[model samples]
Target: MAATLDGLITFFASHHAIRADKVLRDAGFATELASGPKELSPNCGTALRFELSRTDDALAVLADRHVQVDEVHPYVPRTDAWDRSGSPVRRAKRLWGRRS
Candidate 1:
């Protein structure tokens, strides 16, 4: 079964982000590679989107593999059409926990 996209994982480097994508996918977690939102993460330009509900399992998998993550966030992208008259709105809530 495919996992829902509701969480974002930030990395200190693109290398780690890419590796995370592979690790998560291999561990039966769904993931998507997206440009890291500068407002949320300035450490890297790449971020991995994954299932929020399975965050614990996902993090464990990465930790077991010795992969490091800068931060994890609960992200809900704006779905409405952008208004040229104003700045685009983004929804990202930081999740504080053990970082690995």
Candidate 2:
């Protein structure tokens, strides 16, 4: 089953991000390697994208493999006016549509 790319995983290093992509993929999770958003994390130049719904499983898998993560965020890039900037505009709404 393929999952939507709706979550962002930030890491302190590019190695961790890359390893996360591989680990998640190998564990049957959908993942993507993307340029790290500076506003979210300034430590690395890379980030891992994954399905927000599978966050718990993903994090557990990473933890079992001893992979360190800086943070996990539910991200839905604003598509209206900020889409062209290549930088995502975060909304106040949470990933599950509940108010944050």
Candidate 3:
């Protein structure tokens, strides 16, 4: 896991995440695709992680491509799968809907 996610880009649909991933990667920004945290947005199943250092540049690129983001967050996942006591990070409660 990354020590820190410079920035998070949430989208209303996975399509936006996919497009953003390509654009950000092509622009030389470190990016990753991950399951969207429900605490964040309720729309898409995937989200984008970008270098926080280039947040402004990332936003600008998204705007240039006419991509819409639901929200942006600063996130960093636990580096190790197991904790000191061999426990995993607590999973957030999931919300059920007609879709899944």
**Each prediction's whole-model lDDT (CA):** 0.83, 0.84, 0.78
TM-score of each: 0.76, 0.76, 0.70
How far residue 67's Cα lies from its native spot in candidate 2, in Å, is 0.6
Model 2: per-residue Cα lDDT over 10-80, one tens digit each: 99999999999999999999899988877778898898999999999999999999999999988756465
Compose the digit string of candidate 1's lDDT tens values, residues 19-99: 999988898788999988776788899999998888899999999999999999986574443233222432111122333
What's the CA error at residue 97 for candidate 3, in Å? Answer: 33
lDDT for each residue of candidate 3 in 1-38, tens digit (9 for 90 to 100): 55356678899999999999998889877899988876
Question: Which ranges of candidate 3 are over 4 A from the true structure?
Answer: 1-4, 78-100
| Residue 91 of model 2, lDDT score | 35
lDDT, candidate 3, residue 60?
A: 94
Per model, how many backbone clashes are there? 0, 0, 1
Candidate 1 global TM-score: 0.76
Reference-based lDDT, residue 27, model 3: 80
Report clash pairs, candidate 2: none
Better of 2 and 3 by lDDT: 2
Q: Tell me how far the alpha carbon of residue 30 in candidate 2 is from the true structure, in angstroms, after superposition.
A: 0.6
